[model samples]
Target: MTTPPPNQNDIQNGAGSSPPRQQTVALVDDDRNILTAVSIGLQAEGFATRVYADGETALKALLENPPDLAIFDIKMPRMDGLQLLQSLRAQSALPVIILTSKDEEPDEALGLALGADDYITKPFSQRLLVARIRAILRRSELVRNPPEDAPGDEQAGTIGRGRLRLDPARHQVTWNDRSVSLTVTEFLILEALAMRPGVVKSRNQLMDAAYNDDVFVDDRTIDSHIKRLRRKFRSVDPEFAAIETLYGAGYSFADG
Candidate 1:
């Protein structure tokens, strides 16, 4: 008696247990091969994927119906990833990761500065890409559903220092009662600094607080984020000097 192959329903339902809810990921790239490969991989990992070949289409679909997360190729035709990100940031705080090539470091930096949560260079390992996606999703989930019994301002999902107020749940920041927008990564970095005012935080420390442990971001990434953070705050208040940079050391938040 030969054993029979599993049916499609059996496989989908794991023979007995029910399938878990699928998280949706939007993959926007000009490369069909990349889109297919990534979509297949993410599907295998129990995620639902929506693929678009250009930034314009992706941007339209994303705004019409947002996904749990988004990954974009920086070299897309039409609007391009950076432009799409700029447009999206103006309306939504959606988590976005940009894909770049080795030679597109400047574009990658610009994407991050523009509000992308993370970036991966082209020819990246699928495992690493998935890890980054998972890490970002985890952070997003945490922000959405904070622990009810946790202590501290972070637990309360709101922190304030001086005139700066951060609401993790709402993903909102306000300085001197003026609303200021920040990327997810930027918010985490600012929250860490504001949590311990006057305490210097090394680049590594900031990265740990802002990004997943598995993500190995460069020092320049932190610098770019900090630079953008300062710019955003300073735009509202030119005298905003709460973020003090310590050369050869790190950064500190002014207590007063």
Candidate 2:
């Protein structure tokens, strides 16, 4: 596989001109094929990428110089992604996305509990990965610099129900005044439910609210996100019961 030649404007800009710096994504995986393929795919889509062949090496560079986002693969030879994530979470809140083996919930739950923003099952589509990257990045942007006029945004503005409060403009959530850190996907799903408290939202509806129409996400993905949302809130409020399930009828939020 050959790399495409550099863009003419990129060469000119690097030579003597100034341009906006590309958003860099760091990818850590032991598989050289995955590292090479994903890095190329991301670059072709207009991103700067850094790839590492193992978790131990990636962890060091990540601490010294973080990227806008990171994608980690579990089960690395040297340091394993989970340990690296635990260490990084202790020092930084840099947004991270994870890759997990197919149908694996324990690792997914553990990663999300440790503050990962999103996860994609293995054998996933590059299109889906790119879509997830774009979604999380957009949400990150909203958190950093919110616009008052982006009200049309599904995750925009503030929505409150009982002890739960969501300030999408700031990417902030609180349960009974205690702050809760949530992934963009989690926040969006929660936002949808809280927007119409007492009303049930099917997984499909929630997905539509959180993801672009072009991207296809299975129902299990939404279910996992819901599980993480509950787990995060419960960490702060042991009696957190605002989010409810109806079994075969989707989920809802209790305003009272």
Candidate number of the best lDDT: 1
Instruction: Return the TM-score for candidate 2, rounded to 2 decimals.
Output: 0.68
Residue 154 lDDT (model 2): 44
lDDT of 1: 0.80
* Clashing pairs in model 2, backbone N/Cα/C closer than 3 A: none
Report backbone clashes per prediction: 0, 0
Model 1 RMSD to the real structure?
6.3
In candidate 1, list every pair of residues with a backbone clash: none
lDDT by residue (tens digit), candidate 2, 112-189:
656577788898898999988987797776554566666643456567777888887888889998999776667888
lDDT of 2 at 99: 94
Weakest lDDT window of 10 consecutive positions for candidate 1:
5-14
Tell me the spans in candidate 1 whose CA falls farther than 4 Å from its real position: 1-21, 142-157, 167-172, 176-179, 213-220, 234-239
